[model samples]
Target: MTIEPRQLPAAQRTLPAMLQRQAAEFGQRPLLRVAGRSWSHADAAAAAAIRAGALAQCGVTRGDRVALMSGNRIEFVEAFLGAGWLGAVAVPVNTASMGPQLEYFLANSEARLLVIEADLLQRLHTADLARTALQTIWVIGEATGSWQPPEGIRLVPWPAGAEAIAPAAVQPGDPLAILYTSGTTGPAKGVVCPHAQYFWWGVNSAEVLGVGADDVLCTTLPLFHINALNTFSQAALTGAEVVFESRFSASGFWPSMRASGATVVYLLGAMVPILLAQPEGPGEREHRVRTGLGPGVPAAAGQAFFARTGVRLLEGYGSTETNFAIATAPDSPRGGVMGWLRPGFQARVADADDAELPAGEAGELLLRADEPYAFASGYFNMPEKTVEAWRNLWFHTGDRVLREADGAFRFVDRIKDAIRRRGENISSFEVEQVLLSHPAVAACAVYPVGSELAEDEVMAALVARDGSVIEPAELMRFCESRLPYFAVPRYVDLLDDLPRTENGKVQKYKLRERGVSAATWDRGPGAPRAKG
Candidate 1:
């Protein structure tokens, strides 16, 4: 099927204009609700603009990067939108990240200002790093005590009742946000996304996902990720209400959905399994939610989830660099596959040499949207990395997949995570899927570990159902029955829990740091037996 790119609306050429337009269209409507306090569209816009004015007063200028460190709060939204209004890029630092990691991002982004939650500011009071480039450190919280700034840093009070200022004019290609990719592979690279890209992503997603004025979008995902930001923008563009929660709670998911009157929501791959593990109740299907969108829905769980919740789960494949490039329409075929290519986008499977692969062949997934607005600009401060990702005029997604005859694609595994052993290739994800199917397994992450015989060996780190013990020999036998000999795990480690990001993606790097050693291997039931 031939795909043609669509032009974005002129009003969406800049982030500030989009915010202004939303304010005008839905002035009296609730734009954001946090901790039971509602802020109308006008209220949010006014507050954001005021903060923008205050930021300008503190020497933050257009094109400057302002780093924000805060939990999911109303003030965070104001700071983010305010940065856009001032024509500055907002770098949302993950609160869950460590101090050294935060320092790296702040230094790399070269942020001129740091707008932090008061609690976070207090924690950084004694850090030894030079804040030379950081001109201002504004605190956003209630208790405003005298806090000394680090050397060469100016402390500014977060202004109150500051009037809205006129938003700075910005071009379509101007950087809006620098969302750093979750560095599961290595250090996080800032995905430089432009205003036009986000605006179009939100608009197109709303059109396809069917978010509207009456829809209440609830997000437990961190605003630092594209899923939450894009979903938030989709709601704003359509005049829909937004319900923000500080964090995701599996036990509270259903109750929150019902209480917020949410019609559309976002979920990560791990969230589904977490929610499914909670106690079953008649209230599961009682919410008004009509759609749940995002990736990581295991094939086995999809159908059962829909039948239980009465909400259509729309799973898609995309990364922080390319927002919502492919999605399953609401009426598309369900289970396993990540639907078809989204409108205005083209996808193909290519081999290691970048040659296109035949239908049903597993290879790297390459995508290209005919329009530039549909994709991210590049990585911030890393031209070579950007060039590497966009080689051959197509954005090379590191994910491996098989394209079906119907144009739908089934995600196989990440290229980096593929195990090479004795001239055989093993997809860790595929093996994990098979292992997760075992009733004894609650959650699992499969990765390649260094091997004496080959470049890498298959290793599985698992969290058992209700912390029950599963003998490794029994689990290996189950995998051997369902998987190829080369793909069976060579080593198994039982963990109390898997380390996850704020968005619930497994931090494979951390698991890798722990390494595949006998120390992690438990000799209890479900633990693997010693090989002969």
Candidate 2:
């Protein structure tokens, strides 16, 4: 059953309003369960109301942006909803960011206050704490925290339970959260997501998963990402329970699932290989999960996972800028294909001129909502970038995909993630897909390093499976046998582990900057070229 985007009830269109309604309808139902404690709908709603009042006490006013950086927990959820209850925008910072990047996010967001986890206090460098716009700092875990504030900035403890007050009136178009995603070529930019956008995400996910009131959604990804935040939204919509872990642990994942009694889980594509690589356990198949929702799971891995456990892994293609535009049903074949486009949205595969490309041809993905205010509002404080992306009256996804005539789409790679070798554009995604399909490879990131000539060279960082050491030469021979000579990775680096963000996305820019390292193996005619 295709769930088309339809009008949500007026009360459910905004976060604060929706929480109030759900609290009234299901007061005793646990909406959030963490560390053996539960916060029912009424409890959460009341807590958010009090937190909003606390933010107001900190001089936060309507439309003010409150920067929140924390791990996956109930406080993160409360702060986000509380800020929205006050008609303010919550800027969720990536906990992995440090120093200048952290400063850049604070300055760029113009956040009036910062709410951070006590454990993450060290990541905010001295220079970042000295920023002028940051009026106050709210520490979540401790009453008297370790970090001291500079003059003119007040450091306060996180607010506890207070009397519930009237929430600020806000419309669906108001900003809910400003989410930051690193650019392929530049610093991170904040994507301004509106209240209505999240509402639709919840509605659509409820329909796609057939979430029932008794079902519980479990997420290991941090709340900073859309996949996790929107999972929260869908749980609220379906009146379902949620179990959000502080982090993803491949070793303890099955145990956590069994303990939480989770009926659904969310993950990224990279997690698929990592989870599959974990040594098979006697208890692996003994869990309650019915389905998983995410992107990037290989078709073979998806099938293998089902054979191991009765859960079906559903694939979807989306970004911070829009609701999930393309997704698969539980039984859809995977192999990097993102499945069919849902109703209430129009999509196209197009060239630079915006002309629609033929089926099976790869090009930029353009998306627009069939309903108003269903996508992101724009990029915060970056009008030129926003205008450029939203130019031609379509939101340019900056991703290349092949769209079949039946409206099914197969993701190729990000436009900036492509490697040009001797004038032929090679998809880094395709290269990784090949490497991952190999039995010895556990996880890998394929990227481009600059060539001495006009184009780029293919480089790969692979994590070999335990007990099966892969020699660079053997992997090169395998790649050469499967891929075009030019398309094969000329430089290979087998690493103990790849650098990853908190959400598990490989930071390719770090690998590119490292360039050809001492450990890099060269299969080409000369020494590994380091030319930019």
Best by lDDT: 2
Query: How far is 238's C-alpha from truth in model 2 (Å)?
Result: 0.8
Poorly placed runs, candidate 2 (over 4 Å): 1-7, 143-147, 331-336, 417-532
Candidate 2, residue 363: lDDT: 98
Q: State model 1's lDDT.
A: 0.75
Q: Kindly list the per-residue Cα lDDT of model 2 for residues 479-516, writing each as its tens digit.
A: 65445455679899999999999999899889988999
Candidate 2 Cα deviation (angstroms), residue 397: 0.5
Candidate 1 lDDT over 342-371, as tens digits, reads 777888899988899998999999998766
Q: lDDT scores for all predictions? A: 0.75, 0.79
Error of 2 at 197 (Å): 0.5
C-alpha positional error of residue 139 in candidate 2 after TM-score superposition, expressed in Å: 1.3
Query: Residue 480 of model 1: what lDDT?
Result: 54
